[model samples]
Target: MIKQTFTSLAFLCFALITFNVNAQDFKDLDKSPMDAASFPTSNRVTEKVVKVIYSRPQLKGRMVESLTPHGKVWRTGANEATSITFYKDVTFGSTPVKAGTYSLFTIPGEKEWTFIINSDVDVWGAYSYNKNNDVARATGTVTEGNKSLEVFSIAFDKDGAMHLGWGTVRVSVPIK
Candidate 1:
């Protein structure tokens, strides 16, 4: 009985120490937290047509133009470049793209934004962006929103239109 008790105590002590160390190793939330948006967002619709994973960066009292300068390639989000996956072949804006995952980048303009779907996947910021690897380029109309969004966000409407909004600027890209 004493041996069994000692074995149990030893195991309990080891478990406690392991749990304490593991609990401390957990990291806090990222400053620019990752987010995802999918078409057919309805819970009943298990089949997704398109999906985008990106990081949300807060405005933090900074201008949108300052964060994403005009006439320059932006990663489309914070941290890693935004990735967009299409479950099947579809027309994005006016450009036809095959069913695959691609890195999403954008060039901000005064009245429109050029949405670039690059073949490269799992890339960091646009530091290594190469225009030659572009799969498709589409034009997204930029419009002023009545309500300002503090954090950058991407969402898809029921009609499969992708909308990107930040600080009162809204860009809509149609998909069919």
Candidate 2:
């Protein structure tokens, strides 16, 4: 009876430690900031566009499949699923993306990545993803990263170009 009790206690301790570790990971993400205005929020030289500036540190370590699963929609970021509001129609990899806000998600693969622009916004996560509302889909070639990225993030260049990159692969999406 004593042996069984000790084993149960050990198991409980291990579970608690594991839960705490995961909780800490999420806490670190929560501490990250979301500053949308500091970054270039507009590109008037070409056409008026609603620029989206976002960054999330948690995207670094979290496994895409474990946290966001395959064949599902993701809210791009933690709080609001990083959103981009466009004032004019734009093209995303040959697909005509209309003027509006869209949630971006990616289906990651070993060699290729499918970038999805979904109409749904304000979602909690990929749990409620709907494929029928996808506005555009683009395929980007993946390149190996020199170092593994713990968090996935995106940034725009000073020239008003979109860059989707992590680890080592950096895909550029020019604004027209």
Best by lDDT: 1
Each model's TM-score?
Answer: 0.87, 0.61
Q: TM-score for model 1?
A: 0.87
Candidate 2 residue lDDT tens string, 138-166: 77666665666556567666755566655
Clashing residue pairs for model 2:
59-151, 59-152, 60-150, 60-151, 61-150, 75-81, 77-81
Report the Cα lDDT for candidate 2. 0.64
Backbone clashes in model 1, listed as residue pairs? none
RMSD of 1: 3.6
Question: CA RMSD for every model?
Answer: 3.6, 10.8
